[model samples]
Target: MAAKLFSPLRLRGLELKNRIVVSPMCEYSSQDGFANDWHLVHLGSRAVGGAGLIIFEATAVSPEGRITPDDLGIWKDEHIEMLKRITSFIESQGSVAGVQLAHAGRKASTSSPWKGGVKVPEDQGGWQTVAPSALPFSDAYPMPVALDEAGIQKVLDDFRAATKRCLQAGFKVIEIHAAHGYLLHEFFSPLSNQRTDQYGGSFENRIRLLLEVVAAVREIWPTDHPLFVRISATDWTEGGWSIEDSVALANVLKTKDVDLIDASTGGNVPNARIPVGPGYQVEFAARIRQETGIPTGAVGIITDAQQAETILENNQADLIIMAREFLRDPYFPLHAAQELGADVPWPVQYERAKRHK
Candidate 1:
């Protein structure tokens, strides 16, 4: 019997060679949202490492949507060429290229984690952040401006435009960043959203913006390509966005033609106590998959080969997405195949290092 971890899985027109996915991690190396050598090497090495999918980190759909000044962006036409170069290399290595279209919302204007991660003031080139309400993420974060009707429309438009750019860059998959208390998550979680308007106050209203963004992106995204939505599943606090809310949202997303739910959890609040451990969030993925009958990708602390294989064999998730693990070992898939006694091909140039059983 073969390990399910190395099994091929198809989503829409894209057929992954294996179930291992390189989850998007912020490199914070770009200047004005441009992809440079650092991005090329960072992502290219993973493709060579044999990941079936390589999702570029939270790429902002507009200038103000960036999490930091150094975050990647797809807000302009000039950004396409550089992204195209990167995607071409990924595909050449037999890895499907994907980008996470995102808007940081209230989390915008912060410095990169290395630079103390503080919020940059408006006078110092940072713009005022916007959210469903005027609340700031914390005292250290800036108070965001409440997005009115026009502002909301702008967000939708930005997503649509960004989808077009992703296609132009030859990306095979698109994942909407609705997780980790970003713009979309902020709107969906009751903890952060307190508006009484059409886009707030109730479950349906709270998810309105994300639904609208998905619908807009779907309109521009080709039918052959797969679309993914990442959600935090739970806010881990009372009265916050719960796993029940995530299931309901997943059902709704299936109706809108979403391919998979990247089930992650807990980034909507500043002080929610989360029980973080190895495969801790896998239960959320399993429940959402079983309850909604939607394909989900399990993330968070999934570090071992057997753990990933068990999740797939038990039918918990269809895809295994790993972040920090990939950072630690860029060739995780190649190594995992050896550990599981699966014979997966290594990059021809690096075949000298291939293990002999």
Candidate 2:
């Protein structure tokens, strides 16, 4: 039988009621790493609206790993309480809750997009960013400190600790953020990673840290819960991290217990040309999934019901993860189910809204 968008799919022991996953979109609404009512309502509304899985934004594994200091964090045990609340409400709505664990690395300490997203100064809440090499994201950004071997281990330890906190917070899926020219992407792309150590240089050396981080995270995360790794399928620049490289990395990740690759591209370089449009990045997901035989999530500009259904119908990806679309219509899954003539339960409170005259 062909799998449809509304059909349940299981990865490891985690069962998603449908193919629609709310991709992690940063709210930038946290205060001191604590989730608040904004998160509660933001996540809960999506679950109520009928997304099969709701993934929280790229949450930092350590204080310095945050893109902006105001970004969400799970570096401490105290951050778990509010996250649990959001998860509990999501599960109540019959949606599985997932969280993307991230480390911004050299890309850390920028102003929020609303606040111009420029390089924040040290006194004004910015801190020293670290990366595979001493290179900064841009001349406007701080010159990052190269992570020593011990520092690299500390980052891995942070990811491990964050995974433990995620389990306590009741996240059913844990996604390691390794894409978008953040810390991990910095390592993968030669444009940013110019180093002589084992963590950088050739393809194998450059990809080493990310593989190690995944292994460390998998050790702490439960075998029953799904583990996903988000990767930039391409750096979208000449002589940069290419889709071919991503395919090879995905193949390696499969053996490391990575359940899915949330395939999205670009973020490491500034002002690189990206051919953005509807389903712009889906091709990368399709290629990676086909090349590696790994369950992959297709994200970026996936809006319409027909487009999403086609993605699944063609086996382009195992899951369709929507971002801005879900924000625009929290009930997108229910509306899509109706539009595509698929059976999906409407929230009982809104059952009257589902009538056909």
What is the C-alpha lDDT profile of model 1 across 65-114, one tens digit per residue? Answer: 99999999999999999999999999999999999999999999999999
The estimated TM-scores of all candidates read 0.99, 0.98
lDDT of candidate 2? Answer: 0.92
Candidate 1 segments whose C-alpha is farther than 4 A from its true place: none
Q: Rate the local accuracy (lDDT) of all candidates.
A: 0.95, 0.92
Clash pairs for candidate 2: 181-268
What lDDT tens digits, residue by residue, belong to model 2 across residues 221-329?
8889899999999989999999999999999999999999999999999889999999999999999999999999999999989899999999999999999999899
| Weakest ten-residue segment in model 2 by summed lDDT | 1-10
Best-performing candidate as measured by TM-score:
1
